[model samples]
Target: MVGFYNSLYNLAHTHLNDTYELLTSLQGRLSPAQTTTLMQSTSWDEIIFVSQRSPRKSSPGLDGLPYEILDILIRVPCFHGLILTSQPVRFGSCYRC
Candidate 1:
């Protein structure tokens, strides 16, 4: 049991390190125009709900809304949008939460 947990921890660390390296390489390879386009296409609106309490305050004209409700309202749509993107979420033996 201890061995299994240790192995999982090590695997998670290795995966995170590999991800960081890959992202760093990808960042270096992007052109200024491509970076600008990427930034423009990415949604900042979703961030407002995640980082703030109210989605109404995010866009204006709203009520006493909890972040949990705001997540259901906007965050689910953002997740579905990500699923429809070029690089969809991979679900398999490769990654586990």
Candidate 2:
């Protein structure tokens, strides 16, 4: 089963070779000011706003934390600070696969 999966994965990966990115490309990019704005630390209000807007019944992610738990977690000051200052986790190009 593993061998079969690996063979199919390799075949699809070779055929795509990142052409998937091209298909999803946006027509334009952010201006320098817009980029800077986006890169700024997210405020707690922004976090709360986004969390509240998320679906209540959504499934938990790989970390097994649901949006409801996340909303609660952000209310803790230390946790909120950690979130604001934390660097995003970088994953390999094929991490999604």
- When summed lDDT is taken over every stretch of 10 residues in candidate 2, the lowest stretch is 88-97
**Candidate 1: residue 47 lDDT (0-100):** 52
User: After superposition, which runs of candidate 1 have C-alpha atoms over 4 Å from their true positions?
Assistant: 1-6, 11-29, 41-67, 72-97
Instruction: Provide the global lDDT of candidate 1 against the true structure.
Output: 0.53
Quick one: best TM-score, which candidate? 2
Clashes of each: 0, 0
Given candidate 1, what's the lDDT at residue 91?
48
Model 1 C-alpha RMSD vs. true structure (Å) is 16.6
- Report the lDDT tens digits of candidate 1 across residue range 1-97: 9998898878556777787888877754878888798877545555554446544435322344455554554455545453234243354623122
Query: Roughly what TM-score does model 1 have, to 2 decimal places?
Result: 0.24
